[model samples]
Target: MFNFGIFLLLLGAVLVYATVPIIKIFNITTTKGILVVKLSGLALAVIGAIIMFFAQFPQRLEFLRLI
Candidate 1:
């Protein structure tokens, strides 16, 4: 799960950084298409963070409870 989360985070970063090439490859010319791709990337990054958070939740639970 951790590895998958890391992979997703990297994938999202790449998508955001390489948006132009992705748009060219996919023939996505519209502004909406670009927006969609960027939004999906953001969503993937958020999901990856959530996954990582849960993956390590048990180890951090005690500390969290103290707060």
Candidate 2:
């Protein structure tokens, strides 16, 4: 479950990480389009963070314990 949560967070980050350049790629002519893209990315990140925070990743990663 923890790993799944982390994966989701990373997935969200990837979505957020892609939003700007991808929007720019399509040559959106309006400010509204840009705003919408940014907002969607923000929503994805928030959802990811919610999952990550509730995941308790620290309790599951043995490798982290070694470090």
lDDT of 1 at 1: 74
Per-residue lDDT of 10 in model 2: 73
Candidate 2 per-residue lDDT, tens place, 1-67, comes to: 5666667667667656786677768987688887776677677667777776665666446556432
- Model 1 clash pairs are none
Using lDDT, give the best candidate's number: 1
lDDT of 1 at 55: 64
Off by over 4 Å in 2: 1-20, 56-67
Given candidate 1, what's the lDDT at residue 64?
Answer: 61
lDDT tens digits by residue: candidate 1, 9-60? 8888888889999999999999999999999898898888777665644554
Candidate 1 — worst ten consecutive residues by lDDT sum?
A: 58-67
| Shift in Å, residue 44, candidate 1 | 0.4
| lDDT scores of the candidates, listed in order | 0.81, 0.68
